[model samples]
Target: MAALILFSVTVSVISEKGEPAADLLRENVEALADNEYGHNIYCLGYGSLDCPLNDRKVKVITGEY
Candidate 1:
């Protein structure tokens, strides 16, 4: 299924950021695949949203720490 492939790709990207095992990756991929909304958020987080994949929008929060 398309969603399965997308979720796998998303999990790979996240795993590449750190040292993740095959089992962990599989678990994450399965979990994400089941949640369509989560998949969208995952795509957005990794800049995979839409076809062109635009940069994330910046939000300005007043006041400095």
Candidate 2:
């Protein structure tokens, strides 16, 4: 559950950048995964095609982005 939340947050926060930066972001998120289940969760997050939980969610949740 914690890992899922973290994955969601990481996906949510990833910035729009070039391929190298995206690769780095993928690496960093993958590292945080730590297990097969987590890896699956990571894949789900990545497979969302782009950031799903974006700045609008942040703004709604915390009143900032």
Q: Among these predicted structures, which one has the highest TM-score? A: 1
RMSD of 1: 12.9
Which runs of model 1 end up more than 4 angstroms from their true locations? 19-65
On a 0 to 1 TM-score scale, where does candidate 1 land against the true structure?
0.30
What is the alpha-carbon RMSD of candidate 2 to the true structure? Answer: 17.0
The sequence of per-residue lDDT tens digits that candidate 1 reaches over residues 1-65 is 77678766877787789956467667776776664332233222333234222355333312222
What's the lDDT for all of these models?
Answer: 0.52, 0.44
| Model 2 TM-score, 2 decimals | 0.25
